[model samples]
Target chain A: MSFADVNIQFLEAAKYTLGLFFLTLLIAIPLGVVICACAMSRFRPVKWLANTFIWIIRGTPLMLQVIVVMYGPGLIFDVPMKNRFLAALIAFAINYAAYFAEIYRGGIMAMPKGQYEAGKVLGMSKASVNGLVIFPQVVKKITPAMGNEVITLVKDTSIANIIALPEIILTAKNIVATYAIIWPLFYTGVFYLLMSGVLTLFFKWLEKRTNYYKA
Target chain B: MAFYQVNNVYKNFGDVKVLKGINLELDEGQVLAIIGSSGSGKTTLLRCLNFLEIPDKADIYLKGENIFSIDNTDSAAASNADESNISEVENGKNIQTDSEKNQPTHAKKAKPEKISKEMRKLIDSKRGHFGMVFQSFNLFPHFNVLKNVTLAAKLKYDAHAPKGFARWSKEAKAARKQAMQEINEKAVALLERVGLGEKLNSYPCELSGGQQQRVAIARALILQPDILCFDEPTSALDPELTREVLKVIRDLKKDGHTMIVVTHEMQFAKKVADKVIFMADGIVEEEGTPQQVFEHPVSEKTKAFLAESEKSIDEE
Candidate 1:
């Protein structure tokens, strides 16, 4: 495919593509935090709820999840999830939240128990100490893990094509269908490759800034 | 505490009872050393006085008030005082209504919930009016020495932080700063006290075991706690390092910081201990002044344990 052809298709899908990446981020960041808190909760009910959600999401295929979102709401409640793109976005958001939650939980648990005891001994309330002291350390410890999830989120944006939402991969597919060529599909990799490359570099900056959190 | 006491304390981890019925007391200014064999539960007993180990149905007190007793008197008093104040305010009292006065206010109901949460936090912080110095020197590895010492001061003293020239009071900002400075100075006096004045800025990873213990000693002493508990503060060091840390404790004795030390240094305990507790299998086998217990141990367990320790030391 010519550069002109590829650019137009890329631009066409760019609207849906941008919506998925940022929208999923908005949903996942908060849901991920809650899911992480649930997993860490001492109550068995909370832990089980969080773990079961994570297990089911992780166990199933993303394509199946997209199909479920597209039709399941309409089937169960007679509320049509009118836009397949919105269905695609919701499915991807929930799926990646479960993944990001694990990343967060892993980071928090790996912190030394001594830090919490030190906080207590120094007269810190459990909530204040964890927020001001432990959370910063957790953020630092989890930066690499979080970075991996974020970069993967960028690549996984391609999965929106499963619900035919016209993200970069589907944009490339439509170009192939319109013009009988495969080059645009190959060039789609470049968008992901460049975006992922940029994300990896950004995390390196985050890691350096957070180097103060020692074990 | 008006005076610190450990009375008839007993503890066991599963079947292995570590402390049998034990009774002891320290006046506000005296230092007491507990010397015993490893696994003798000296640390366990020291922790009990602080209610660190909640006995499986036993009593521990500070200033003679049952600390482990869960009657909720402190919290209840707080809530009652608050309720009376609210009722008084509702009936027209002089208290400035919280800034949200214009709202019909969920807060009269919410205030009790909020205050109780705050009260629980306050009570927990109050527990550490006495400080702990671990053998490993559990300094916040993330912060500098200055930040570690000032941390409590910063959080406790500063009520409302603002912005601009007074965005935060430099003094308020330096509540921690001043605590760090005074801590640094006292720590220096303590380092000079234990002779580590030159090593103030040093991190724990960079210091020798003896030096780290000295820093731990300085950290605990900086608070001027009613009683300072040592969990084998020098036991981790080599002989040379052990002497270095011991010299610091000796200086603490001179300075009059009340201390409950868990030690294996028999000679050190013999020299300075006003009371000696010989613990075996968690019960106090026998306890008295170092003179009474060391020179003429009454229990066979105490006698054999001391003799065996002396023999081992002599061989070493």
Candidate 2:
């Protein structure tokens, strides 16, 4: 393949990689928030279930999780798994939500207990206390950690190759093997580096935007 | 009739009885100053009144309306109140009246009475009746002076506004705008009145402790609470800063705002409070006019606390 052809192919694969990244985040971030609420729930069984889910996801490797999520149901229940991309997407979302939920819990717990009391005395309901008073501060707090997870997600998209999904790395590997060349593989690193760099800048801007609270 | 009444208020935290059967009443414009050392349950008492620390057993009436009930009907709670007082369920759902008073039942039966929607609305509305200022001046660190003051007012308006008034209808939008304009005006006037007009745009962290406490005062006042509770509002500040906050509170007294101030500043209490309650060991040891409590305390606990507090002030 020509260098131009190689670049175009990599770009097409990059689109898939980026799609995976955004979609995983779309599902994971909100699910992480729900899990965070559950982790802090007053009901014992709910909190236990949420904590167990987080523990299992965090304790296992992403590669192992991807394999299990993709094939476990099909193998165990006599149902063949279809939609390779959807399986990988679900695996990524579940894995990331655990980490994101941990970060959220930490950020929320770091806030002084008095903040809730103050909100209550101001006549805010329990739900509004979390929504209006607590969540904003938690977002500011978890941004740096969140940025780290997001950047990791950008790189970890390559893990989809475990399921033989043609993400950026797999595409580059195929190109190198066909053309008997090695440059495309190195070029794949450039896309990830650039994406991570942009995300770092975005998160820095976010931190500055929310730097209203101080000692 | 009293504007606010707290009857037999009791609170327990894991077997530690923090507040034991405290009863108090406040007429309109009456300023009650609660003075006590740490762990005296003065703060807990204030928290219970606002339902911040849900009392194990209590009856709080605002303008003769049962503030805890969901329907705002005194009769719903009034009928339940006579039901053996066997410490009914926390949510008032199971308030069982025991007819077998003489037959000592091994277990108490709970009669399910779901609190009505109207009563929930009433309870929420009545929450605006008492505003509390904490010792740490717990201002929302994320919001600026203006936002802090305006937020509660905005919330109160949203909670009580006509349905769909928050929507996009022209009439709804106009009414919302008018309501917001009024709230904003009230907030501004309150901040200005608290002498924080210049700091409206400043974040809580950017302001001094005294300034932050003043902002908190302004935020509470925006709710137009019938009574304001100050839980050592100046405790975090230096004497100089404390003076500034106390001055603002003193002005509130002059304006005839009903207040319950918990403080270590005996001089401020003597100057500002209409009724001084000296609490010790989870109960009111002595309560009377400032002169009666400070000059001639009836209880030994009150006299000792006063002397020790005076010594600390002297050392300072």
Candidate 3:
């Protein structure tokens, strides 16, 4: 009921929001590269499977995916689903990885064929060409697009609320219902604004550093 | 046998025949200039030499060794050629015992012996013997001038380093450091030779087009390729920049470095070439000395191409 109490409660809830954001990024970014590789694999079946999975994930809503992930196993397999946070994390990671994978694929495909030819002429193996020559350029290219996805992800962490995970937005909603006061819900916007602003500056700095070597 | 030989090389892209049984030869320290118009397949031939494009049918020899051969007429024969090449090396009956073969055989035998292993080694060393420069320069944009020149050489050294020691062992680390120092020194000398000593720290984007191409030349030279192949090295540059690149190539010629240049620069070709080849419609229309080709071309196609090239030069 007190402002200090409300602040403490929001701060506790902020931990979950921040946890989901960082953990999802940690899992998704590298997973995206793996998925991108699968989608670009020379083998037709692998490419098709990866592409189909990406299509399904991107086409469906994150909120719906969260609910399905949290409850699907219990209904489909008749098993008890106890870990709500784990289910939400899985849904968020898989969904974001698909978007990130497409961003990576786009960046890689945009590279000039001459780059590969140049590497071949230098007697570099295909692995060396991808790791040394192509990947760095791809990273530079995908930075802005990746930044946009990351910003979207910050807000998307709120979708975990559908699974009743105690992230900041869900906690704020609980406070609103319990106290019949609306200000706590509005106060959650301040946390999101501050988090996204830091991320914007961080991405700007990253883009500048990578620009030291122009693609 | 010639130091480098392209025997009846043929390549087709889809239904379009790009190279029609082209035959050519070059001795050591000779520059063979290939002159042709667009779609003449000169670039494709150069690509084939670099192994960037696999010819549908071909035999490529470097330094009297059959480095590449494909008998697309029969897939079985093509594979047999590869198998024979590998068996020759494995049996130690190979004529040329290069540094690659000097490695301990028992150490090599430790891995599950696949035919690809021997074939890859042969192709890798053979490919290393020729350095290629592209029309666009194709310098690694993410690396600086020095790094661009040194990267491939460093990768090669690391790859061919002795096999037994753990990668993080003291001896391995020390060997790596020493090798890196030597490669860096050679790279510096090469960049200086190409008139780019001052731009070692500069990235590809920071340099002029000519400077970038010169960096490319330095990068190529660092490998100590037996023959350097230039695929229209100056085509992307303006007249002034072209002169600078031509000067570097001329200097390389004076140093007795063997080269294959694909170019439309008639005057440069005439001045720097030991042998001149006029290609039209994916076949050699004329092959002779520069004087013979330029002054007295045998084929009508060669004569018309020369005249057209001269007119373009005059207009420029």
Best by lDDT: 3
Provide interface RMSD per model, one decimal.
10.7, 10.1, 9.6
Every candidate's lDDT? 0.69, 0.82, 0.86
lDDT of 2 at B93: 36
Q: What is the DockQ of each candidate?
A: 0.28, 0.42, 0.44
- Which lDDT value does model 1 have at B60? 44
What does candidate 3's lDDT look like per residue over A2-33, in tens digits? 78888899889888888889999999999998
Estimate, for each residue in A1-215, the C-alpha lDDT of model 1 and write its tens digit: 67986888787777787778889989988899999889877577998999999999999998899889998989999998889778988998899889989988887767665566556555666676778777877788888888888888888778878777878898888878988987888888887888789889999999997665345
User: Which regions of candidate 1 deviate over 4 angstroms?
Assistant: A11-15, B12-18, B57-126, B159-212, B239-241, B307-316
Report the lDDT of model 3 for residue A155. Answer: 90
Candidate 2, CAPRI quality class derived from DockQ = acceptable
Query: B72-109 in candidate 3: lDDT tens per residue?
Result: 43453556566765333333222232222112232233
Q: Clashing residue pairs in candidate 2, if any?
A: B70-B119, B70-B120, B71-B119
Ranking by TM-score: 3, 2, 1
